[model samples]
Target: MPLPSIDWTAQQKAARQRSIAGGGKPGLTRMEQLAGKSGREVLEGMMSGELPYPPMNETMNMWLLGVDIGRAIFQGIPLPQHYNPLGTVHGGWFATLLDSALGCAVQSTLPAGRSYTTAELHVNIVRPASHRTGPLRAIGTVIHGGRQLATAEARVEDEKGQLYAHATATCFVFDVPMA
Candidate 1:
């Protein structure tokens, strides 16, 4: 089956507009400001510019587009700088996109005072992409959310929904340390 056409450029522009409208900027959120907020609340804060977005997103040319209780969506633009010697987008780029989505999906499932770190990640690239690939999206969804651990999976797909890569991640859930 064929996926529906998507205007990726327009989608990207719209998302950026919303981010700016909400005063979203790349930086760090102070621990104090995160106190007692559920994972979903923290993510929502970032989306709404009440908290800082991660600097890594800027570095990777990716942005978190949306989030829900156990899901996260991110978009990335592949540029020449992200290519490997073979003249294709590097696997690391795919891994980073998948990792970000997977981590965020798990994070979105946590309760207040809880956090997670990626304990394991595995990526499988099924196709190649280049700067010309336009915008690609990594959609992550939590498979299991537990007190001590969580698992999630993600897929990197083009605007037309062609799968480029897929990955799974396991995260260790823990309590945020007291200040």
Candidate 2:
């Protein structure tokens, strides 16, 4: 069989468009735009390309696929580069996906000028993921959102709904200065 191919052309085009001359704004500048909007609005903006996608997501071949108040979903593919010494998808990939989803779920509950950082994360790898796993999704939902803290959980599953990993996280919420 022919080796599978991954496409980077579209992502490259988007990267170029995110350059300063291409109308890309810096993170702080963009956050200013989110100052008064809801977290859901900010996340939607990111998905729609109105805001810059997080560099980490791009680097890891993950993207924000969907979001709503107190919920978020991300999609990623396990690639050859993600393999560990044991020849399976690295645990870090699972952790990253789970953390991202959980944090974003909390983020989706924030008001403008507010942000959050993962204070704690607990992950359980239920199964191994390989490149053949095809597309995987990490779905997150917020369990609690207090003034200074938020808790959320997430699961990484394949298209057929087989769970690969699950995680829970607590995030510290804070306000950032408006642009």
Candidate 3:
């Protein structure tokens, strides 16, 4: 299979920015020493060029935990209000985040004229996600590329690299002939 050409749409990025910015701020902060780039710029670099990490990488979420990437790092924190009536973080939260990460990883490496859908998904929830588990990170990678079907692997782990959950999926590719 040919290497994927990445293109993160402007509209998709704008929406993310709006979510982050929330309501309009009263004003701007003093240059903030290190002026940050818009999510779109960072994504553009990834799409047309390169980023320091994989797509769907939300290291920026670290602000919530007051941590930095690769330093005293915890894992992605459990989402708030993500609890089920059973008094535990809902499995759906894990599934949603995993699905997002998995799908985005594929999208990040996909070529135009082609699209993908989950043909099969198997998530093994070894441990429950706890709001107190510090932070968590879900990493996804491709395991196989086929003419009509592709396979991928994903893991949701805590800061200490302890696996909380693991999943493997088969993605159906369509609308484009294999090149």
TM-score for candidate 3: 0.57
lDDT of 2 by residue, 49-157 (tens): 6776676765677776668888887778878888899999999999998998999899999987788899999999999988888777788999999999999999998
Task: Please give the clash total of every predicted structure, in order.
Answer: 0, 0, 4
Better candidate by lDDT, 1 or 3: 1
Winner by lDDT between candidate 2 and candidate 1: 1
lDDT of 1 by residue, 3-109 (tens): 23557666666666676688888888888989989998988888777788888777778877788889998889988989999999999999999999999999898
Candidates 1 and 3: which is better by TM-score? 1
Better of 1 and 2 by TM-score: 1
lDDT of 3: 0.50
Candidate models: Cα lDDT each: 0.87, 0.78, 0.50
Candidate 1 global CA lDDT score: 0.87
TM-score of 2: 0.82
Q: Rank the candidates by TM-score, best first.
A: 1, 2, 3
TM of each candidate vs. truth = 0.92, 0.82, 0.57
Give the top-scoring candidate (TM-score).
Answer: 1
Residue-level lDDT tens digits of model 3 in 1-179 = 21123322233344334434553222221222113433223323333323332333352232111111111111245645667887777777676556645644554455445556888888888888667775565666667756677777778876466888877778887664334
